[model samples]
Structure formats: structure tokens, C-alpha cells
Target: MKGPIAILGARSLLGRHVVNIFQELHPDVCLEMWTQSDGVGNVNSVKRLIACISEAELIINCHEARDLSMAPDREALHFHNEQFVAEVLRNSTAPIIHISSTLVQCSDFWPNTYEPEREASKYGIALAVKAYCKSKHLAEQELFASHRSAVVLRIPFLYGEEDWGSPVTDAVMAANIFGSIPNIGDRGGAFQIIIVGDDTPVGDVYDNVVEAVAKNPKRPMSTYNLPFLPLYYIYLAIGWLLLAVNKIFDVSGSLSKMPDPSLLYLIFHHWTFFNTNKSTNLLPDHEELSREYVVKKSRDHYALMNPNRVRTSWQLHIE
Candidate 1:
């Protein structure tokens, strides 16, 4: 609780937020950061990471390929995700907390998986996403198979203050900035999604990691699903529609950015979002927020960014 904690992918939204959470929760704890932009997969970074592992009592891996549409080939993903993890396992004796995705549950590629849903091979998931899922699945498999002390948090559509990017963020922008609500044709929002960590703030994830590390269970690894977000299909629909409009019209007057439709469909149509019975049982202090709570928080953040708003005579700061 008072020493060093090394974090990989520190530049990522999750990584940055986790670092903040550590500082807030454990003021005395020392933090070491590594980022892909800093050449994490390079030889020098390996040496630094190895050194970090040697000194730190805990290591948190928040690295992931966020862009599914432009990801490298499968082999490259494996090298980045699987081989990188293997290297960490080889050098580190400290317990690791790996941030993984719930999308892996959709595929049969991962043997001995705990997902309740059937394999999603028939679901027509995009090629890049399938590769991404395979990469994460393999990493999880590697961690467990290595017989090391690790904990895997299978997360879903994460949204909170200072998010780097996510489908939920896109939705917030559509609603708050463009004044366009997502509408999925005539589906009448006949869709269900279980957004893990949707209600729980990103800081809570770090808190859970800290608590798990404190316990130091003798088990090699434990896997737990985060909180399930209440389904709000219509809102997500609006986000998707807005994203679609942005893509076709290029109305943003910049890079045409939006969550891939395949990914959106996967979350809204295919993936089975579940309850956080396991996480809640283990970490009782973590709270669950309603959709209204997240929506309101997002709106407030955007309001401060609105150009027409005047707060303390300060100009709006837009991302």
C-alpha cells in the first residue's frame, strides 16, 4: 500500500486515470509509467520494464490496441499482446493486474473460457475486431497458463471523466455537442447490452486492483467481470446514427472519427452483458451508477466545454 507500482500503457486513458487514482488513494505510493509511444516493445523499454518489475510490488497492464479498423495483422497483434505479456511474465515476480476486454467472450478461440454466450463466429464480427479479441484471449490464456500471480478484469464499454475514447464517449458527443439523439431505424431499441464498468468509474478499477494486490492470494490468477450497465439501446442508437452521419457527411470538418459499426453492433446486438455479482461480492465499496448518472455527468462536462457558456470568465476548453 505504500510502495512502488509500475504501470504499462501509462499514456492511455485507462492508464492515466489509474495513475491518478493511485495518487489520490495512496499518496505515498510511487508510480512508474511506460507507454507505447515511448517504445514499450523495444529492447530498452524491456530493460526499463524489467527494472520496474524488480522494484515494484505491483504492475498494472493497461495496454491495448484501441483501433480495430486499422490494427496490424494477426501475427503482429499476437506479438504485441501475447509475446509482450510473456516477456513481462518472464521477468516479473510481482503480481500483475491485466485489463482485458469482454469481447473475448464472443469467440470460441479461447479454450476453457468462462463466457456464457455461445461462440460468436457466426455473428459477423469485423475482421480487425476478431483479431483484437483473439489477441486479448491469447494474452489471458498466457497469463493463466504461465502459472503466475495475476488478476484479469474483463471490462466492457468504459465511460468516465477524461476518457481517451470509446463508443460511449462518441454517444456523449453526439447528444451533447450535435444535439442529435441516436436512432437505430425502426428497431424501437430492441437490443440489450451489458456494458461492464459502465456504471463504475475508472478509478474504482484501480482501487479494486489495489485491494486484490493487498490480499496477495496464493492462487495464480483470478478473473472477474466488472459491473453491468443498464441497457439504454435508444441512446446508443443515437450515438451510432450520429457517428454514421459524421462518417458520410464529414460534418466535423476534421478526421472522420466514429466507432466502427461492427463494434457497435457487437455490443448492441451480439455481446451478452452480465451482472457484476463477482466484482461486487469481492469489492463491496464499489458503487454502481444509473444510466441517468453517467448521462448527466457527461452533459455537465460538455456544458463546461460549450463556447457559449461563461464560467468565471474562462473560455471553453474543447478536446
Candidate 2:
């Protein structure tokens, strides 16, 4: 058997993408999707989630309410997730993979270098990231305490088709036909990226989850940032080009909408992080890391998207 499978909160934007990928990988497989959409802010919503955990052999939870604008009821969300993991460990034997975010990575980065450990920006965006870390940590710890088979895949910033208003989404939207970017005073801090590919770093996170399920062993939880090839400079160049285009054509073209306080700053500041080195050690023999491979893949992806005013990639793919 490839595996027993289930996904929670499968109706959300991210959840839908997850579902699409899972199905694409395994056709003819029964995929059960559960949502806490109605009355999700209450305890009963989570109780429904706990009940569903009882019947599954493997569960991948991609549930989240990420909004930088509104302060979430962190305690409520934390309690619900914590209890859900606790219940899964207590009643069922299946392993679980909980989706987390790079917002949780705490690393330092040196100004003159890409030494994240030495010069981390985790603190820079720390406040914006706190609640996500707290809730995910609560649930992860319980999975460990109960000796459950589970892993947490802390995804960094994701850039792909079908994402609307995502950090990259705005940039992709704002790309100008002039092949130039307007001068924007501020450049955003760096966020780590995870490149999706076959036999990917995800294999590492899943290996642990699968092993835990098979062994019923208590494992120490660790985090890895699936670093991408495009550094902060790549995004900065894209920003510069946009400003130049706006200057040349006297048009915003596909550039991002300027927010009232500052449109460009808001777009530039949104970032995520991850380190895949740790995960690299755990993958099966079939997959290997190649910096060149990822860069090539990403470059092709950007070209295919074609950041030109003539083609509406945003409307076609990102909405």
C-alpha cells in the first residue's frame, strides 16, 4: 500500500493546492477532505476534527488562518490544534504531517554576508510570526510526548500559480511591460523559499513521519528551511525593473498596487524562510540536491509565467 491518507481543512486556498498535488501524485486514490470552516472559531469545530482523526491511518493537516492584517485568537487556534494532535496520538496509530510555515524559523543573518545563522532576520519579522510558531509548537510537542508517529513540514514562502495576493503574486502582478521597475526606497528583508520537485526535501519530513508511524517511537522534532536559489537580490532586481518600466511608460502595467501608507514597501516586506540541509540527509537514495537544478527550474518557471503586460499570467493562474 502506498499509504492511508486524509487531509484536514482541505477547502482553503493552500489546502486545495495540497489536494491537487496529492491527487496528481496518486490517481484513483480515495482522498478525504475535512473542513472546520463553519463555527471553526469554537471548540466544537476542533472536536469534529478530533473525531475524524479516529478513522484515518495517515493525516496531513494543512489547516491555518494566516492573515497579517488581523490579530488571530492564537490561544483558540493553538488549543484546537494541540488537542487534535493529542487526540490523534491517543486514539489512532497513524502518523501525521502537520503543515507549518517558515515564519517559525529563527535564524540570524550577517549584513555583509548570507550567513543566516550569523545574521538572522527571524527577529526582524518575529512579531509577525509569533502566533504561528506558538500554535504549531504546541501541537508538535504533544505528538512527541505521546510517542506518536508524526512530522511537521514547516513550509517557507510559496510562489506558484493560483496564489492570489501572495507576496510573489503581487510582484508577478506588478511586472511592467517596459522591462523596468520604478525606484522604490525600501527593499524587503529576505525570506527563505522551498523549491518543489520530485523526491524533494519533503521526502525528509515524510520519512520521519512514516518511520514514526511504523516504529511508534518518540522523536525529537527538528526544523529545516528548504532554501531556494533566488536570493533577496533576485527579488530586488525584479522590483527595480518594475519601477524603471513605470518611469519609462508612465504606466503601472502589471506592477503591484501601491498601498496607502506605502504599496511598494508592503509588497517588498512579505517574506518566508527555510533550511533544507537537515532534510537533505534524510531523503531516499533516489533524490539529491542540486543548486543549479533548482535555479534552472525556477528560471524556466518565471519565463513560462512571462512577466509581461501582454500576457495576463496573474489573471490566468494567480487570480
Candidate 3:
């Protein structure tokens, strides 16, 4: 019989994609999705959630708040994973993979730039993660506490789009919507950063969880950094290419006269990919970003999402 698979965070960005991929790859398996809705936690939606958890052989927890600047419910976040899920998961002997963020790594308290989930940066996101890391780490601890099996992927700067949340480029295009805001900073070309533009095969991180869980010796939860610098370079090249097009067609003009570098940097500089032992090892096997495809895809989606917004960003193709 096919194995039973439970996806704890089906409604999340990563959860949705992973679910689709898993279903496509393993169609025959029993696929169960769990997500909180209408003020009800995962169990509320399905009265048999605990039952499902008890019977399922593989449970992938992708449920977690991703916003960096925003404040999350510390009490709630900790309880869900530790007190609640821990109790339910304790009964199961199957392997469980918990999807976690790398907000913990951005710290100086530790001797190394990339330390375990224990030593996290205490600034901004890292600060926030530090508060919750204890719980997330505890969750991981519980998952392995029974000594069944577990894997925790410390992801950073995830990219791509979802039906609800705008694509990564959505932020980039939001300002461009009303036409150029003026170049308040440097003029030659404004450099905007994208998510760690790293070509790290993030997909492999997912794969490693599946592989690690299946094998023996119960793989220890190892945290990997999905660094950021790569996504920055990726967006830089894209920006330059666009500038070249503007020069060729003489499409240079200002709407507001001075573009706010601060505003632009807010969107650009923080975009990052990750530095993961798993992603680095796995991405090499797959193809990286396709700029041409991404450009077309991003623009089309942007237009659809913000129909009334100005379309000057597409002047190259329109007129």
C-alpha cells in the first residue's frame, strides 16, 4: 500500500508548492492537508486531525509565520509546535520534517556566521526568531525527543509566487506602477537586490528531508543557511539588462524626478537566497533561474494583479 502523508501547513507558500510537487510525484499516496482557517487551528477543521496524525507515516510541518518586520504571536507560535503538536506527534513512530526559517542564523553572539539553530542573531528578524527559536527548536526537539526520526530545514529568503501573496517581484513593481518616482540617488543605474539570488538548489533541501527520513540511523536535525547574496546578483543583472533596453530605445524620462533609494533599497537589499549544505549539493543537478522566462512571467502576473496601475514598466513592449 502507498504510504500516508500529512502536510501540516498546506495553506502556506512552501506547503502549497511542496504538496503539489508531492502529489504530482507520488499520486497514489494518501495526501492529507492541514491548515488553520477562520480562527480555527488545524485540528478544528478536521475533527480527526489527531487521528490522522496518529496514523500517518510522514508528516511535513510547513506552518509558520514568515513576515520579518511584523510581530508574531510568541505564545501561540510556541504552543502550537511544542505543547500541542508535540503531544500528538509523540504517539507516532514515523519520521516528521518541520519547515522552519533561517531567521535564527543572522547572529553575532556565536563564534561562527552559520551556527546551529541554538545560536541565532538577535537583530530584526534574527531577534524575533531568537524569541521563537526556543519553541521551534523545542518542536524539533520533541519530534526527535521520542527518537523516532526528524529533519528541520532552516530556510532563508524564499522566492516565487503564490495565488494570494504576490510574487517576489510584486514588491519591485509596486513603485514602478505609477511610473518612475524620480532618481533621488545615483542615476547611471539603480541597483535593486532580489532574494539571495543564489542558484542554490533549494529543491534539494526538500529532497533531503524525504531521503533522510526514509533512511536509517535517524538523521539529526542539521540547520543549513540559504544565504542571500546570490539573489541580489540575479536581480542586478536583470536590472542592467532592462537599463540597456531603455538606452537602446531612448526610453529615459522621469515621472517624479528623484527615485527614493531608501524605498528602493528597502525592497532590493534584503532579497536573498540561502546557503545550505543540502541546497548547494542539490541545486547543481537542476537548472537555475531563467531570466527571460521570469521577466515575462513577472510582468504578466503584475499586470493581472494590478490592472489599474500604470503600465510604463512595460513601455518596452507596448510603445
Strongest candidate by lDDT? 1
Residues 1-319, model 1: lDDT tens digits: 7668889888766677678767866788898877777665577878877876778788899876533432224555677778888888888878888987666664322221234432334344433256677777778888988887888876664544444244433433334443432432222111222222244322222232212221122211224322222333554575566657766775542212333344544443332344455545543242465655655554454334432332210111111
Tens digit of per-residue lDDT, candidate 3, span 93-185: 667777665545443222223243443423434333344555566666666667767777776544434333322333334334534221121
Q: What lDDT is reached at residue 148 by model 1? A: 76
Candidate number with greatest TM-score: 1
TM-score of each: 0.62, 0.52, 0.56
Residue 182's lDDT in candidate 2:
22
Give me the displacement of residue 228 in model 3, in angstroms.
18
Ranking by lDDT: 1, 2, 3
Could you tell which candidate, 1 or 3, scores higher by lDDT? 1
Model 3 misplaced regions, further than 4 Å: 38-46, 108-118, 121-129, 132-134, 163-273, 280-299, 306-319
lDDT of 1 at 248: 71
In model 2, the runs with Cα more than 4 Å from the true position are 38-51, 69-72, 79-84, 87-91, 107-128, 170-189, 195-273, 278-319
Candidate numbers sorted by TM-score from highest down: 1, 3, 2
Candidate 3 worst ten-residue window by lDDT? 310-319
Given candidate 3, what's the lDDT at residue 304? 52
Report each candidate's C-alpha RMSD, comma-separated, in the order given.
12.7, 13.9, 15.6
Model 2 Cα lDDT, one tens digit per residue, 92-176: 6778777765444442221212222212234554333345456655666666677767777665545433333344433343333
